[model samples]
Every structure is written in structure tokens, then in C-alpha cells.
Target: MGELDTFTDALDYPVYVVTTAAGERMAGCLVGFASQCSMDPPRFMVWLSKANRTYRVARDASHLAVHTLRDDQRDTAELFGGRTGDEIDKFEHIGWRWPTAAGAATAPVLDDVSAWFLGRVEGRVDGGDHVGFLLSPVAESPAGPVRPPLLLLSDVVDLSPGHPA
Candidate 1:
């Protein structure tokens, strides 16, 4: 392995489930490559693989709902990460809903998650096989009284992704 690979090997980043919609189409996927990229302007970036169906929908999506996962939510992770959207309807298996507020975009918010936020897509950056979606937080779900420990990469290292990254 290279030096960069060795460096990243020691890190365990938090896992997130990002959901978005365009017209009648909606998609969500397990994401490990995302972070808060800006502080002053408050921007978050999520990297989606070009091969995933979510990427196709996100291309025309105006907003995305990013959900935080907990250690106990491994089953949810498996559903999103292990099954491809091309083969099945993931939403039918999970509890989710469209934003009810007036003039809200059709981003699907996941239920029973640790926390979540709605972000308007600001821009897109082509990063080889992955495209980074720059987001500015427009809304957020109310925080639960207690915050649980987050699910990490190390916890799902053995999972086979639904689609090749």
C-alpha cells in the first residue's frame, strides 16, 4: 500500500445515509465520504459514486437530507448499503417522508435516525469516480434529548456495498 493508503487506513470516519429526490424519483445510499468543508459559509460536501443510482437522481435534485446513523442502526445500513436501487424500492422497506413545509423540495427524510439535516445543493465537483455535492444547510431535524454514538467505517468494514464504488 502507498503512504496515503496507510494514513487513511488508521482512520475510522462516521457513516451517513444521504437521501435526495427529483420529481417522482428518490434515492438514498450509505455514504462514508462526506464532511463539513467550510466553516464561515457553513458548507457540507458529500461524495457520491458515479455508478450509483443516487448520483443520477442527485444530478437534478435541489436538496438532500443527510441522516446520521448510530451503532444499532446496522440493519438500516445494510438495507441502504447492501441493496442496489436498480433492483428494489428501498423506500418501501423503510420509514421516510417528503418535507411537508410549504415550498420544500422533495428530499426524503429518514425516520428513527440519530439526527438529520436538509441542505440545498450549491454546486458539484467531479472527483474522478465520485462527484462531490456542495451543500448549504437550509433546515435540520430537531435533536433528540440524547445523542447516541455514531456508526463508523470500522463497524461496517465487512459489508459489501450494494453498488461498486
Candidate 2:
């Protein structure tokens, strides 16, 4: 372990809930390592920890849904971040609707999301402990009436990972 640092060190980045659909179900989790990696072609990248069950499922996924939480939706963050999908379906507790897209699987798009993007995996890179998935946004939507402030890392400090940390 390294020297102790302030909690703020870990609370710097914006968090997102990433979802993937495989067969008849969907899996999602709170993701801290994700960003727009390209501009001209418009690419986004998300790193998924190998230990997460969501990662295992996402490995086989063709499309991924990235959703930002509204500041009031801390519970949504807790549900996806703190609990493992191996035990329960997180979508069961959240209100969401499936959007239709050709050549891609469907994942639930939460009703209260601040914003969302559906991406097709273009490439993947192995980064030791985590895998980086490069995505091309095929579709996007902004929450119009529900344009609430986004939930950040600080708001989810108490949530424990469903998998081993």
C-alpha cells in the first residue's frame, strides 16, 4: 500500500454507470475511469476492473450504454456501484426503457439519467488490472426536463464495491 492520501484525491473525477446487454439480460456498474478519447472520429473510452462481474459480462457485449446520474440519484449510484449484479438485477429497482437500435443489443436507459450515450465497441486494450474499451457513440440523448446536476465521486463515498476492492 502507498502513503495515506486525502479522500479528495479519490473524489476528483466524474462517475458514470455503464451498462451492457447480453442475451436476455443487462448488467451495469459505477465507473470512474472513463473519458472522451478522441475528437474527430468521436471516441470514448471506459476502463473496467477485471474483478467486476460487470466486466466479465461487458467483455462479450457489442454495445455499452453510459449514463450519468442526476445529483438526486445517489441511490442509483449506490445500487449499481455497491451491489453486485450477480446477486440482484439493478434495473429491477430502477425505472428504465429500452431503446431500439439495429446491429446492437439493448440495454436499459434510465428515466432519470442526466445524459446517456450508446456506443459500439470499436477496440479494446488490456491495461493490466483493467481493460480499456474504446467506443464510438452511435446515439446520444440529453435529459431535457430532468436536467439535474450530475452526481460526482464525493457523493458516493460510503458505497462499497460489490466485488472485492
Candidate 3:
């Protein structure tokens, strides 16, 4: 078990902020468990913790907006990942805009990012403590080499989770 922890910690991957809105509520959270699950149809998956406030909003959301932050953009990660949306509105402190009805439904799109993609929710999988939301790409902004370096777990390891494990 200790070795598994060590092995997993050794792998550095990009961290993402996933946002969703439903009814009159909006929520977003820092996400690390996400990946491309399909190629032909271009499907993506994002895992939201059961303890996160964003998960509640995403459960019935039609679409989700995922963003990749840069190394210099740790503040965005801290805002979304280190604080509880139940107590504060994450968008009020960040540079964000609501999506058009034809866009990503009520999802908030963060303008401060290296890249972003809007995905339509296809289905949900009950994966133990976390639920997996399958997404089909609706719109995407490709990142270039000139953009900031990808944010990683090591960058956010120092911060404490707003919602306890």
C-alpha cells in the first residue's frame, strides 16, 4: 500500500478546474482525476469527489467546462480547490464569464487558463467515493507551446482541501 502511494505520487500530471451550473447555482472545483476515454467520438471524463460542493451541481448539469492552468496560475487552483463553494462564490474572485445558452449551458468559463474545453454530459458512473462523468466534446480551445506550463499536483500539494476527505 505504501509503495502504491509512492508510485502514484511519482507521476506528475496536469491538474484541471472543472465547472458546472444548474438551476440558479454554479460550482467549480479542482480536479485531477480526468482523462480522454474515447478517440473517435472524442469523449472525456472528469471525476468529482462526493465531498465537493461542485459535485452536487454537476450531478444534473448538461455540460461542463474544464480548464488547464499554468504554473503561474496557482491562485485559481487555490481558490477553487482550497476553499469550499458552500461558503463562498468561487467565481466572484476569479476572472470568469457565463456561457451562452447554446454554449456550455450555465457553466462558468474561466478566462484565465492555458486551455479549455466545453463537454456535453453523456453519462455518469458511480465510482466508489467519486462519480465519473463522461463527456463529449462540444467546443475546445487548443493550447500552444507559447502558453504557460501545465499546473501539477506538486504545485497544489501544499494546500489543504476545503472539503475534508
Highest TM-score: which candidate?
1
Tens digits of per-residue lDDT for model 3 on 12-35? 899999999999899999998999
Off by over 4 Å in 2: 2-11, 101-104, 143-147
Query: Per-prediction TM-score, please?
Result: 0.95, 0.88, 0.92
Instruction: Give the worst 10-residue stretch by lDDT in candidate 1.
Output: 97-106
Report residue 156 deviation for candidate 1 (angstroms): 0.7
Q: Arrange candidates by TM-score, descending.
A: 1, 3, 2
Q: 1 or 3: which has the higher TM-score?
A: 1
Q: Considering only N, C-alpha and C atoms within 3 Å, which residue pairs clash in candidate 2?
A: none
Q: 72, model 3: CA deviation in Å? A: 0.3
On the 0 to 100 scale, the lDDT of residue 7 in model 2 is 52
Model 1 misplacement above 4 A: none
Task: Please estimate how well model 3 matches the true structure, expressed as its whole-model Cα lDDT.
Answer: 0.88
**Tens-place lDDT digits, model 2, residues 49-79:** 8988778888888878899887888888989
lDDT of 1 by residue, 10-76 (tens): 9999999999999989999999999999998999999999999999999999998899998899999
Number of clashes in every candidate structure? 0, 0, 0
**Model 2 alpha-carbon miss at residue 81, Å:** 0.3
What is each predicted model's overall lDDT from 0 to 1?
A: 0.91, 0.83, 0.88
